[model samples]
Target: MKKYFNWANIRLVLIVLLLAFLYAFTTKRNENRKLCNTTVEFQDGEQLFITHEMVNKLLIENKRDVSSIRKVALDLNNLENTINQHEMVEKAEVFVSIDGHLKAVVKQKTPVARIFEGSGSYYVDYKGTRMPLSAIHTARVPLVSGGVDNKNKEDLYELFRMIHDDEFLKKNIIGIQVLPSGSLIMKNRNFNYDINFGKTINMEKKFKNYKAFFQKAVQDSSIYNYRIINLKFTQQVVCTK
Candidate 1:
């Protein structure tokens, strides 16, 4: 019994050593492997502001192609930082697969509204941060003009968020103009009238009143009679012809 137990112990030790050696050899071989290919995937499939080629170009370092680089020399964190530097990219992740291929997963910013200020145009994302216009894709969102700056961006974002959340407003509202006095005027699609939204306060009550008025007007076939629809009042929708 003692001799048999000793033999079993020796076999176990040899097996453990062999497994460790194989693991080390495989790790070393993997480290020496060259980058086989790169894949870029966008989290938001509908909106692609950044192209795969653009991300691949960003992976290049010191005029050296990423494909020519070895796995041991790759810095995934550095690559992710470089990709995140893009104004359109909200977040990016870079990693090497077990097969020696590099992959970048990126999420682009969501533009809620487009701002046309002076001769420059840019996008305001859902997070209320300014994003540069992309040459690759254009988002069909509400156009904003006047009195839109850093100080009032968050307020505008709130207003846009409400509009985006409401299916009726999202479909009908096409433009927004901010007055110098901080009042908002909205332009509706298929209608010549402008909406006088006094201030961002009492927004829910104001939208509710406007919707009630709109539905009534539509039922009566009087939707196109007015020039201005004011929703500043507490419980009433004041209109002007």
Candidate 2:
């Protein structure tokens, strides 16, 4: 029994030493391996505004010989931050493999609406975050103009989201304008009539009435019959001929 217990202890100590040696060997091997390749990929089938070449350029700017650099020496968090700071990038994730390969996964911002204020135009992304307009691509979102205050952007964004949710509105509505009296107006793509939306309150009921009235009016009369359609009142749709 004493000899058996001594043998068991020796076996346990040898196993631990073997594990330690393997860990040290792998650690030294990984530290010595240099970065040989880099890959950049975007998620969610989004259009490429920031290309892989651009990301490679950024890496090259930080380190001229990025490919030759040791894997352990690369600052992955700093690289991720650099990519995340880009105007078009929404998120960035960096990974370095033991095989000396660096991979960067990025998510690009998606625009939901475009605001044309004064001479400049910018985009409101899906997160309701403001993003600068891209010269390479123009998003075909709702164009809002006229007297839109920056403070009221969130309110207007809700309206835009509602419009986007409705297929009829998204297909037909071309432009939105905020009047000087704090009322809202929407322009149709097919007709010359103006949709007087009044204030941004009680919009669900207002749009319901407007849609019902539009369906009936289109079947009964010509599209040119009404110059202005008012949907501001509760449970009423007032049209001016």
Candidate 3:
């Protein structure tokens, strides 16, 4: 008894007991608070379920129907239940403000690029994530040809994905020329010029160089006068001079 009750041992025991009590108390309080919470936030255009109207309805339904704050909180928690049913939802959170407003923010799947398959295209984003295409007509997007063969479809989609993400380049990417050998070329609309990218190697550096070269050509007005711009060379770019 005396050994266990030594000053140092006693202090350590008290600290451990306090930590355990704090953990349990905090956990229980949080669980209880979350169990009966209603106010939440949804990020704009991110949530898959529970539209702004449903959220408002929940608030109004409980505001007039429930007198207890606990009941209001639980009603808000129910909002999360509806959002979680969507397979694309990453996570959801609800924010209740002191001024009596609810906000629910949710994370959703982001598709990088889509492939033409079965009249129902398949999309894949930067995270290598795959999803279906939107039920709408798309234009100006490079038509992926030759299909996703055993060669390398991922690279093809990712290449197109990068071009799509860059607004500056996307506008200039008139079309993609995917070869049977997995090579690529970018067409520019500025002067109906064909760019022979060749093998998709050193993409960023090559693309930047391509842009800079085109800019200089546009400045000079002689490069754009050409029918094609070839950047496949190791040291220099070739164009129809």
Candidate 4:
């Protein structure tokens, strides 16, 4: 009886080992098979997506036999580096799917401010990251001068948000001026209305007050009646000519 019990236990162990070996062998074969399959979703910029165009340019230029375009093993860092080289691309990511499909995602920099460095001009994103202007891109954005820094750039983004969220200011905002202290001054293009929003703060209250005031002030002529709407005080709205 004891000998029979030991034999049964040994048989179970051997069976388990055999199954593990077969599983490993099958996995290796599948991995080897995957290396032969290829697929690419290249963006050629016909859709006007500039970041995709930048990435596709690098890949098409590489002489790495991407014709069959399969088995393309790309390092994520390298993919990011390639897109980062483009002035308009703020960040990028690349990954291959289980079905051997390659996908690249990019975050295009939304140029909020165009700054003059010297002879050349550069763009600043919301985070204040400065990038050079590419001739291919002519995005509508504000031009900032007087040496705006990273912190000023961030402040500008918030100020932009405050104005954009307001129903009146969103369509009317033409451009914003950034002072040395991160203060904001905006102008409307339609009638050249000046708006003084000193140091963007508590946007909810400020916007609400503007809306209420404009309800009466803009009854007839939406422009030329007020030169500037000062939103600096907490309770009073001072209009200037």
Compute each candidate's TM-score over C-alphas: 0.90, 0.85, 0.57, 0.67
When summed lDDT is taken over every stretch of 10 residues in candidate 3, the lowest stretch is 64-73
**All candidates in order of TM-score, best leading:** 1, 2, 4, 3
Which parts of model 4 are misplaced by more than 4 Å?
1-19, 30-51, 57-61, 67-87, 117-119, 150-154, 164-168, 179-184, 199-208
Model 3, which residues run further than 4 Å from truth? 1-91, 95-102, 107-111, 135-143, 149-151, 164-167
The regions of model 1 sitting more than 4 angstroms off are 1-5, 62-66
Candidate 2, residue 117: lDDT: 75
Ten consecutive residues with minimal summed lDDT in candidate 2? 57-66
lDDT tens digits by residue: candidate 4, 1-241: 3544688889999999999999998666544443222232333332223644456656434545444443434455676687667666666666665555555666676655566656777766656577667656575555545545665556566665554445566666667666666556767656655667677576567667777776767676654677888877858778887
lDDT digits (tens) for residues 1-241 of candidate 2: 3544688889999999999999999999999899887888889756556777787766544666776688877778898888888888899898888898888888998776788877898888777888898767777777888776777777888888888778987787778888888798888887889999998899888888878887888798765799999988977888898
Candidate models: Cα lDDT each: 0.87, 0.82, 0.61, 0.61
Query: lDDT of candidate 3 vs native?
Result: 0.61
Better of 2 and 4 by TM-score: 2
lDDT of candidate 1 at residue 228, scale 0 to 100: 98
Q: Point out the higher-scoring one by TM-score: 1 or 2.
A: 1
List, residue by residue over 138-168, the lDDT tens digit for candidate 1. 8878999998877777778998888888899
Q: How well does candidate 2 score on lDDT at residue 144?
A: 84
